[model samples]
Target chain A: MTHEAGIPLGIRFKLLSDTPQDSAAQVVNEVVIGDYRDLDTLREFARGCDVITFDHEHVPTEHLRALEADGIPVRPGPDALVHAQDKGVMRARLDAIGVPCPRHRIVTDPQDVVRFAAEGDGFPVVLKTVRGGYDGKGVWVVESAEEAADPFRAGVPVLAEEKVDYVRELAANVVRSPHGQAVAYPVVESRQVNGVCDTVIAPAPGLDETLALQAEEMALRIAKELGVVGHLAVELFQTRDGRILVNELAMRPHNSGHWTQDGAITSQFANHVRAVLDLPLGDPRPRAEWTVMVNVLGGDYPDMYSAYLHCMARDPQLKIHMYGKDVKPGRKVGHVNTYGDDLDDVLERARHAAGYLRGTITE
Target chain B: MTHEAGIPLGIRFKLLSDTPQDSAAQVVNEVVIGDYRDLDTLREFARGCDVITFDHEHVPTEHLRALEADGIPVRPGPDALVHAQDKGVMRARLDAIGVPCPRHRIVTDPQDVVRFAAEGDGFPVVLKTVRGGYDGKGVWVVESAEEAADPFRAGVPVLAEEKVDYVRELAANVVRSPHGQAVAYPVVESRQVNGVCDTVIAPAPGLDETLALQAEEMALRIAKELGVVGHLAVELFQTRDGRILVNELAMRPHNSGHWTQDGAITSQFANHVRAVLDLPLGDPRPRAEWTVMVNVLGGDYPDMYSAYLHCMARDPQLKIHMYGKDVKPGRKVGHVNTYGDDLDDVLERARHAAGYLRGTITE
Candidate 1:
């Protein structure tokens, strides 16, 4: 958020856990974290805050219910959060709402998967551990019958999906306030590698205007249906048939909306603040005609600061952001945002900066 | 700067001075008053610096001369600063360069001024104290022959201008590096109250693009002629005859270019850092179609923070930059920069933020 504004744009952090004292020290005045296990601690922290929201849906349903009971305002309340937090619940709820989701089957053992895969509905079947799976973890692609054996005894509920070939991935982000006002940023196209986001291009180049509108409508429907308070990121798959399919959902600031940090009228962070605080939501229009954002994998550089400076001096428009973190390999350290009048111009800036951080000589 | 980008930007001050215990620790980093009195001390402190320039050009001319003498690199060297430092020299130089300037007669005595105003120019001549005047101070507008007595006896070197009829004042800021590369930001229409800049609108709405270009060209010519190092701000007047006249020159970062700090592709500070360091220049393009900057006067409010918060909440795009200072009437403590696709869009943002800071509301 700091790098996107090319200056410090304000985004206050609200930690729902007590383990972030060191991080709290970094921002002495702006943030207040609570001991999640202590209801009293959580209540005390939430009282004076302008808005009550979550980074993740880990807060107990009762705690959220209690906050709502006291009029303290738990954003996506327990009722809505349950649908987003549990994949099975989301599928059931979304299916009930007539939203298109991938065909899936729940199984407790390997025999059900074998029975499903041999029907030849697909060559490869995708197995997913429904809860607590992120990135590419907790997912498997099984080709034949023998390879799917471990899941029966893995002690995790398994969900199988038909492998569908799609054109690309798309994300539609909508910011909503308590007043029932919502604004949508441009649908962004994202590239994923090993289940981690690599880059996001705003406005989703080559996207049909009608389809884009449909995607936004879908995102807004889910946000309104679930009564999301801040931001909702609706991930979608753009199939070769020019259809968008529901992939997943995130109820807070998501990686897909990062491009808006620098490209749009109001960064997601600031807009999130506005929405949660019940301030008027800002225009979600893109400042530049086109913009792209790339996530920096920590393993890409030894000295992120020096490397970041090199990128900055080379292309002042390349807004590079480095999380104050120790770099390892393939960790999502931070990201860079770039914009221009054309997609090629903005995309080059994003790609080149990411390549520089990745030690590749990008064009 | 703290108030503008907000405290969230975290731009720390690094004070360089000599003497281990001088009174430099009040705000910024180590106020190491580097001994400019000695060459070794100067070089040691300046070593490995990204840019060696001035806060304001008050360094000994000989010191700059010596730096240039040793090929140590200096901008606007003694030669250029001399013109800015002396009123007589600037007038003479501007005249020699075939630029339009108000008719002027250098007067060392009171009787000489009265005689010149009476003979040809008539009544209502302006008297100015050369070299150290800013705001409305050190200047006098005389409507009659009897009004020149005080300055005539104060032993101040006074020069007189024809007081031409100017429709509006404008500023053209151009930056250049040692390699002779230069770029100019859009010309801005300036509004001044008591000779202190109150507001600036970028591209000067209704300004002729051709004429604005001509004004920019003239500023570039002066920058090249003066061998300006960092940035050169040219104060110009659009006369009734549709001709532009040069009024004043600033050799360092000037108030007029503050909008670029947030609205331009390359900020003036970042560009200055590049220029003084003799590095490759960044893009000087204006990202927004329109931008407005309003100076925040100190005395208008008892406290700036509350107003700042109000402004932030009202308009998230208002980039309020307050130079940490105590409030006093008519004092420039900070400025707010707002930009958008339309002139009115940004102008409204700038105006509301300023009005809030000034404790005034237009309903």
Candidate 2:
């Protein structure tokens, strides 16, 4: 998606991929197959590049710091990226900044997990690996100490938190440039199914205007405090009590902001590119009254291309974005975005298109 | 632009470029550097391709026929594409279809050119080579037989057209699928400077409602009549007396429709991809009340990237699309699309960005 956005800006991409068939590698004109963990590979990749950015925050922080020492510019540099890479660092930083967050503490073992949970909400708590976790992986929602043992088995330090009683999930997506220019997209409601983002509604349908502004301001503050460049997606939980707390932070373009591709005047991916290039940001305003995005998770059927005809015929305004990956069950192969005046219609159209593409809806 | 649109559709491109550094080749992943005019090269390039399509109409018609014989699906097939390749053939075909067109005839030489002019609105007649012309090339406006000799020097049949005393030039862009589904975009007024397209205003501001519809219907009819299986841009001369006459036909995505990239529900490039793929067509509705596109022609300044900060800061809603090409005098290196409820604002924003990018505007 960033590559797509970069083209119009005359930005040429030189991607480093683990495999030739990786979704992004399949489309990028210039690609280097290498292990990003190796400092030499990172140095070679950064040689002629004007600036280095990422779609994932998995690159080793030491290697990024090394690249910076070599006078190579890295967006969301080591310091800012470390927070996204380590949840413990993120929680501590957010706490220091007085940002609202769930009660969390670094746990040593199963006993420590129990102690951490009891300090807030008893029995049910969320245990997350401090680093290298994504899309529900390396995270556990445990009912008791016995169930909490799984997270500690990986030998990675675990951060246990009191899982808030949240009514819904929301995301505040913002972009920041090296020069400190920033723009905030409207807060959006992101719905997750089986720990994977399922749908997102821009302007968060019925969200209080004041609260939305607060979320936007908080996200902007987070971006600035972290010295982050490019995109910063603040995953938020709107609690049952009507207060919002930061649930997670992503230093790259997040799934929750995908709807901006068709819904907003300037897409998150486009703005991320602009931010990384240190160019002034574009407008983050939504183009429609309501916009809905639904993920098309891979299912038993691998041929999503065949379903395009039917889905498009049903809703001509449907915007489908496929990742150019071979479909596998539960994999995120693509997503569909729909926008219009009516939220119900937009939601149904997006859902129907996504379902059809996943081969879950025959009609 | 089409390659960018194809990415979200998961369409992998196999480009046949004349050089490795061609603008499209710079972005397309798989490129075969070879002369497209060579039958053997074309055949080799089509070996693994499921379908053959073009960004231009220069490939020999016979070569396309050969590809079709090889079971390769060539969208806007030879028969349909010939109209865009040859002006004389296009004029004859449109006339036979009862479509409104300027009075024209094939001229054998300078004497015939004068005789052809006498048959219409005499001298200062527009003369164009039957084939191979773009961006104001292969065309001439001759005042007399002495000046008409220049066109005959090409050794190709020259098409003599009555230079209509038109109020303005307009373009109606439409897309069609192989399955016969078609959609028409609102008519747009195209402003040309020195025979090169300078600016475009979507829906042709203040145009008569009936005339706009007529123009759209005419474009749709022409697409159907020509069996055009992708985007067809019907260029028209809106006469001083308020009648539209067919000026030209372009089978591929045209410059006039560039505004659709940021202003319409689905861009012409995207719809063209869907049409060529035989997928259901997308909507051609405008997302804004008024959209304006201005071409960024290359000038003495070769660096357009440096102007991004100024242009983007000036108009956050501005959408800049730069082609990956070396800047050369009078060449189209990029374009700016600006849209809003107010036409004048949109026009000014688009023109300003384009001018800045072209280094024609300092502030």
Candidate 3:
């Protein structure tokens, strides 16, 4: 998707792929196949690049610091990226900044987890590994000490947080340039299914205007506070009491902002490119009254082209985006976006197209 | 641009680029570096490809026929493509179909060109080669027999056309599927400078509604009559008396439709991809009330990045699209699109950004 956004800017991409069949590798012309974890490989890959950025935050912090020492410009440099790479660091930083967050503390063992949970909301606490986690992996909700043993079994440092009763999930997407210029897209409601993002609606229909502005401000402040560059997706929880808490932070374009591709004046991916390159940011205003995005998860059927045809025929206004990945059950292979005056109509249209493309709906 | 559109659709492009530095070759991963005119190269490139399409109409007609004989689905098949490749065939066909066209005839020599001009609006007749011409090449506007001798020197059949005293140039862009599904974009005013397209304004501000509809209908009819599958751009000369005359025909996406990339609901390139792939076509409606596109021709400055940064900072809403081509004097390397409710604002913004990007305008 970043490659797609870069094309019109006349930007050339030199990608480092783990395999030739990787989704991005299928499209990018200049690709070096190597393990990103290897310092030597990272050095070789960064040789001719003007600025280095990422789609994933898995590159080791030490390697990024090394690259910076070697005079390579690494966006969202290791100091800022570590907040996203480690939950403990993120929680500590947010606490220091007085940003609203779930009550959290580092726990050493199952007994420590019990103590941490008791200090907060008690039992049913969320325990997350400080590193190497995504899409709901490396996190657990335990009701008791016995149930908490599972999170400590991995032997990695864990952070326990009070599980707040939230009304729904929202995302505040913002882009920040190295020069500090920034823009925030409207807050959006995000729905998750089986730990993966399923749908997103821009402006978060029926959201309080004040709360939306607050979320936007909080996201912008987070970007500045962390010295982050590029896209900052603040996954948020809107509590039943009307307070919003930061749930997670991502330093790259996130799934929740995909609707901007067809809905906003500037897409998140495009703005991310602009931000990382330190070019002026484009407008983040919505182009339509309502925009809905639904993910097309891979399912029982692998032949999606026929379904894609059906969806296109069904809705001429539908914008379908597919990642060139071989279909695998439950994997996000594509998404559909629809926008119009009526939110219900747009939502239904997007949902139908995504379902059809995923082969979940026949007619 | 086609490659950029194909990315979101997950279409894998196999480009047959004449050089490694060809604009499309720079982005597309699967590229075969070879001369497209070579029959063996074309055949080898076509193998395993689901269909064959083109960015240019220069591929030999006979070679396309051979490919069709080999059972490859060639869009805008040789028969339909020949009209775009040969001006004489195009003029004759449009005349037979009762489509309005500039007065033209095949001229044997300079003396015949003079004779042909006498029958029409007299001197200042335009001369065009029957084959191999684009962007003002292989074309001449002669005031007398002596000036007409240059076109005959090419040895190819020359087409003599009366230079219509046009009030303005307009373009009707349409896309047609092999299954006959077709959609016409709103007619746009095309402004030319030194015979090259300089700017395009969608919905042709102040255009007569009836004439705009007539032009669109004419383009749609021409697409059907020619059996064109994919985009067909009918360049028109809106006469001083309000009649629209066919200026030229392009079987693939044309420069006049570049505004659709950021101005329309579905871009011409994306629709062309859908049409060629036999997929359902997308909507061809303009997204804004007024949209303007200005071509950024290469100029004295070869370092465009600094100029690009300046333009982006100047107008946050301006959308710039570069073709990834090396800068060369008077060559089209990129374009800028600006759209909004006010036509004048849109036009000025686009022109200024384009001029700035071309290094022709400072401050």
Q: Could you give candidate 3's per-residue lDDT for residues A223-315 as a string of tens digits?
A: 999999999999999999999999999999999999999999999999999998899999999999999999999988888888888888988
Model 3, runs deviating above 4 Å? none
Please give, for residues A1-363, the per-residue lDDT of candidate 2 as tens digits.
999999998999999999999988988899999999898998999999999999999999999999999999999899999999999999999999999999999999998888887787597999999998999998899988899889888888899888899999999999999999999999999999999999999989889998899999999999999999999999999999989999999999899999999999999999999999999999999999999999999989877767877888988988989888889999999999999999999999999888888888888
- TM per candidate: 0.72, 0.99, 0.99
Q: Which residue runs of candidate 2 sit more than 4 Å off their true CA positions?
A: none
Q: How well is candidate 2 docked (DockQ)?
A: 0.89
- Candidate 3: the clashing residue pairs are none
lDDT over C-alpha atoms for residue B337 of model 2: 93
In model 2, chain B matches the true chain B with a TM-score of: 0.98
Estimate every model's Cα lDDT from 0 to 1: 0.72, 0.92, 0.93
Pairs clashing within candidate 2: none
Error of 1 at B50 (Å): 3.8
User: Per-residue lDDT of B231-348 in model 3, one digit per residue for the tens?
Assistant: 9999999999889999999999889999999989999999999999999999999999999999999999788988999999888888989988889999999899999998888989
